[model samples]
Target: MSFTTAPSRWSDVWLVTAARGISSCGDFLAASALTLTLQSAGAGGLAVSGLLLAATLPLVALAPLTGRLADRVDSRTLLVLAGLAQAGICVALANTGGPTLMIVLVGLLAVGLAVTQPVLAALIPAMVRPADLARASALQQSAGTLGALAGPALAGVLVGSFGTRLPLLVDAASYLALVAAGLLIRTRRGGGRRPGPVATGAGIEARAWRLRRDPLLLATVIGVAGVVGAVGAINVVEVFFIRETLHSSTTTYGLVTAAWTLGMLAGAWIFARAVARLRRDGALAGAALALLGGCCLMVLVSAAVPSALLLVPIWVVGGLCNGGDNVFGNVLMARRVPEPVRGRAFAVYVGAVQGASMVGYLAGGLLLELLSPRPLVAGAGLAGLAAVAVLAVPLRRAARAERDVRPVSRDEPASAGEDAEPGAGLATPVPGR
Candidate 1:
């Protein structure tokens, strides 16, 4: 709350950032290794999709429970225990041989991720003041992007030399970083209330934050989910696209995919500098939409690249957009939502994204049987672009609504007709649910 706490907050940010980067590297290492193993075995797109589904379903299904748990339980406890469990699960996965068993283990790994995701997300806002939220989000995002950038390339090399099990082991080791971070992080969100825990008890009862309630957040979240859904199948199609369509080697696939993540790293910092200028939540939301659209445009353009080498530049462009989008979304959530309900908001957002990705995964598997990789990639791009176009109008309306209304302080009552969305209330408080 005070400038005195600034040093501590930045420290907390660094600790979280380091741990996140390492853990992300492990996750991607394991994933790329597994995908490589499956593809090299000629297991086909359905097999890959099934693998993806296993990893994703628990996040969507568990969002409600995990979100509440994030709010109700100690973050340190969750991170320490979840990280340890994930490490053990990865070890088991490495030793196991069967695809069915592998899928099951991956799902278990994701269970840890689901818990940690919201826990960390909610805690970041708690660590820093309002002015620093954008920078903190950028740091947090950059860590994840950097970790992701490292993971696949590591997997590519490790898998080629020592086989899949070694990369899996490395991933297992990465979980310990989360455990260390949990122990080291000074900031924690839990059953105990922090400063300004809830705006008003009556307001909490009448109008809890829900993703569907705010027009801007609702529209922003839905738009993001839509785009992810549109592009999700690209994950499934890409292995084949790189390996078969472009005749690239396995290592090439891993390295090239990482280029997007590298771009994401740069984009996070790049956008963070600009975020201060976009003070309004509406402006932030609009920026996110624009970035998402740019990402899709890059995807559409990638359809024509004749070689895998060419994908690096295209994906870099997309990755930059992706990273910027992430920063804006995080800033939007931290800016607009009250502190107490942030856990639920982030969980719901993550769930929406994973769920949309689930749909895309299934579609990709089915479509692979009917169409080749190039056309499928093109279609995915077009679908994502269309989602952006359709969502633009709602975003504009939300922006206009924001511009029209004078903002209210926490002690004041919200305007009666400020928002008409059902079950909606002000970020502070309002008369109606």
Candidate 2:
């Protein structure tokens, strides 16, 4: 599809995008304000870590159920509820002064976010035609990246001038705006279809096995998880790298982070155009992984480079690669998975990424005790490269297999039969038929 091709449902796409972008900005603002609040209250490192844990740990735990709900329920309704819940949490946060209360509010907010994410992912493929999926994915990502880039700075300004509570109030208002946007979206898929039976533990396991049967989709999930795990180490050691290794000030660190965000925004913009011309499959996903690995390697080089000025552009490139990988990964999942099971697949994907990142954070902390930031950064780069090397052949084979398969029409039942492995027979119809 040409990048310029406007689908009839473009308004729906933009509405969803706007909702996510605004909500994300509010989320970041709330997070920053929460952190600042804790810091000013003289909270210990453990207390701060507890806050972070509250924000992320539920994502891993509730992802499966949330994903299932996304598939069975009206996504617009789920989004609306999630937005309202988050807005309430933010309002509560604004009023609460105690650290314990703040922690509870943040956890509730995180739950809302966790529920919203997979539903949003599942909703996108249904929002636009297959041809425009890549562009739509890119546009969605661009909105998120732009929001993330702006949110922190806005939070910093608000907290510095007014106070942390004001930002929380603003964040609550943003969630109301998100709810408004959610209401505006109209899905072609009926809003009130009876959801399939909720998956039990055994059923969840079965769903996972089905996901694995699709080689290309599995490969995409693993590749993304690996890269995320590897690159995540930088989050742990970046402060030390900036201050001790490079002898840069706190302002420089902020600037470097902004540079990466800017790069992500640019990358998302560039890839929206690029994806229109490229084939959508595992090979494209693999290429994106390779680019991401190369970017991580650049981070290693940045550590060794003497000039802080040079690091900005390097981080920017890293951000570009990160953004590209995200776009390609989303497009691949949308194309490969059937609508019936998309929520489960996305749940697993999100879990894998988050779980892997958690592992990386723990490992990075351990490694920092024994090694300098430069070596740790270099190791992260190498880890990314290694993951790409291991997955390259499988990804290529999956790509070829996909290329040989005839495309499935929108009206066709995505699953060939009740017992058929989803996506296993891309070129063939059900055996009985």
What TM-score against the true fold does each predicted structure earn? 0.89, 0.77
Write down the lDDT that model 2 would get. 0.64
Which window of 10 residues has the lowest lDDT sum in candidate 1? 424-433
Per TM-score, the best of the predicted structures is 1
The RMSD of every model to the true structure, in order and in angstroms, is 6.9, 8.6
lDDT (Cα, tens digit) per residue for candidate 1, span 15-34: 99899889988988999999
Residue-level error in angstroms, candidate 2, position 406: 8.2
Error of 2 at 328 (Å): 1.5
For residue 305, what is the lDDT in candidate 1?
95
